[model samples]
Target: MKQTEAQWQSTLRFAVGVTAAFVLCEFLKWLPSFLAAALVAALLGNLPIRPPAKVAIGLLVTISVSALGAFLLSVWFRGMPFVMFGLLAVWMLLAFHKMLGGGSPLPPLLMLICLATIPVITLTAPAYADVLPIALVRGMVVALAIIYLVWLPWPAVQPPKPKPLPPPRETSTLRLALLATAVILPLMLVFLLFGLADVLPVMIASLMIVANFDPRAGGRQALALIVANFGGGMCGMLLYIALSTTPSLWFLAGLLFFATLAFGARISAGGPTAPVYVIACNAMLIIFGSSLGDSAGSFSLWVTRVFQFTVAGTFAVGMMELAWHPPVRLLPLRAGRSSGSSPGKT
Candidate 1:
């Protein structure tokens, strides 16, 4: 397929926008710098806002909830297994409740809480109170960065959007809880029971799979995530080896720009498959960040990350196959309707 002009424009905008945001994050001396860079990308990618007001609402809600939930989960449910299960149940119900509103920012924020609870609470629960302040501040950075990036003159264009599904359901709610549980529960249990530390990659991979699932598309999305993440991880690994000899902030930043442009170009040329770059670029960045200063350690981590993403993607796909296998009854208007109909038109 020939690359359309819109797609080419989108590539340039994404390349420019993401690289610029990442470069600016390098200068946030007050915060943990790499974490800020990585998360700035994250918050921007997932941001579900179109207007300025909702941007503020989404940002505030995501940060406040994640930061607060992190602290609370750590203190309240750290070592207790039954208590943890209860917490997941409650969160699942809360997600179901909020998702009923469909257009509210709270549902997205709420799921982020589910994912954030693992990283924030799991790593810092008992002995790491000092980190919460950093995380909270980091949340602020992500919030502000998202808003700034959204309004950038060269804005990243989203690919043609998939049809939006309707409001929540028992199946959707259960699937939400299922995906979160698959990542969070096992990691928590492992941490509580035996104490392991490398769950981050797995969590990220599982998240990529779960979040990208579209009932309308079925198994193909999961397969694409698994492949793209693996390929991008290898790409990042190769980049890491080449760059580590003379590493500097400027060099890393420049590489990020060019690498992003490459995949963004592919999206332009390759059609809808372009957005798979999210999984790919995310893997590259995460691997790049992990590989920053140590050659031996980076090599070891490089292999592990690829394997973990494979495992996580497969696990999520299997879980969804069992839990939410779909010929989902989309809303009346959304079903068998042309693209002209507005989503959520009841």
Candidate 2:
């Protein structure tokens, strides 16, 4: 596919960023959380976010949300399934609503807020009460700072933005949110009750598809979104294993840089397959790399992470298909009625 000048420039900046920011972080041994890279990728990948100030403000708000979520989780959320479910439902609405307007640099922010609020990390964190807020605030600041350095030299200009998506029907947003809550709440309850350490990916995949998808795309598209996340997650797991025991942090960082560059190039080129690859790489980088600088993850834990993600992914995709009713069909359906139609086709 022919790439745009903007595409080329965006990819170049990202590739350079992968090397510079990640390598420097490794060398300095800073920001020991996956949230760091995930946050950066959210900013770097959103090429439409021109004039760095918008990105800055969005990130600052995201940081605040993350800290607050963490603080709340630390203080409460134990043995309170109904309360937790209610809170998560609200979070899902806030985090996923931007989809009605197309993309937002804020999905990652929402993802962070959800993940931070969940008991997954808080239950296990050491002095988590004290460290959770500090760690999150510090991590967001450092990640944003690194990203800022990477973008500093680029001459900023407000690029011509795409027209905002026509407001999605209120019914559509409400139904989608309800469907997501249905899919996610049960799975989250199960994971939480059972003491799972890695429920992040599952919730991430569920809400992400909701937040990421265009309303016109329908249930088949929902399935594809989940598949991409699963594929990316598997690749991410492999990378996690590779970096798990590497003796040299610099070597690990170099490998990460090259990997990031490849993923960023795909994103820049807007290749059909780029999203899966890029998402896979980012998922792995955040999961494994975050564990590296602070906590010690084990073989059993890694395996559980993969297994539980599979269970959660299947649940999310399956339930969403069911929730959409008429079951995502092969032949065309009525036009302009619901999310299932393929606009303009007879």
Best by TM-score: 2
Clashing pairs in 2: none
Candidate 2 similarity to native, TM-score = 0.74
Candidate 1: list runs displaced more than 4 Å: 1-9, 24-51, 96-125, 129-133, 136-143, 146-150, 155-183, 265-275, 293-298, 322-346
Candidate 2 residue lDDT tens string, 44-145: 765444436666667677766766775575458656746765776676555555444345646454554445334555654434445545655665566667
| Native RMSD of candidate 1 (Å) | 10.6
Enumerate residue pairs that collide in model 1: none
Off by over 4 Å in 2: 2-5, 19-32, 73-81, 98-108, 123-127, 154-171, 240-246, 271-278, 290-301, 328-346
**Per-residue C-alpha lDDT of model 1 across residues 30-140, encoded as one tens digit per residue:** 332334444444544454233366665665666566556655665676567577567765664455345433554333543544443354435535465545445545645
Instruction: Name the top lDDT candidate.
Output: 2
**Global lDDT for candidate 1?**
0.57
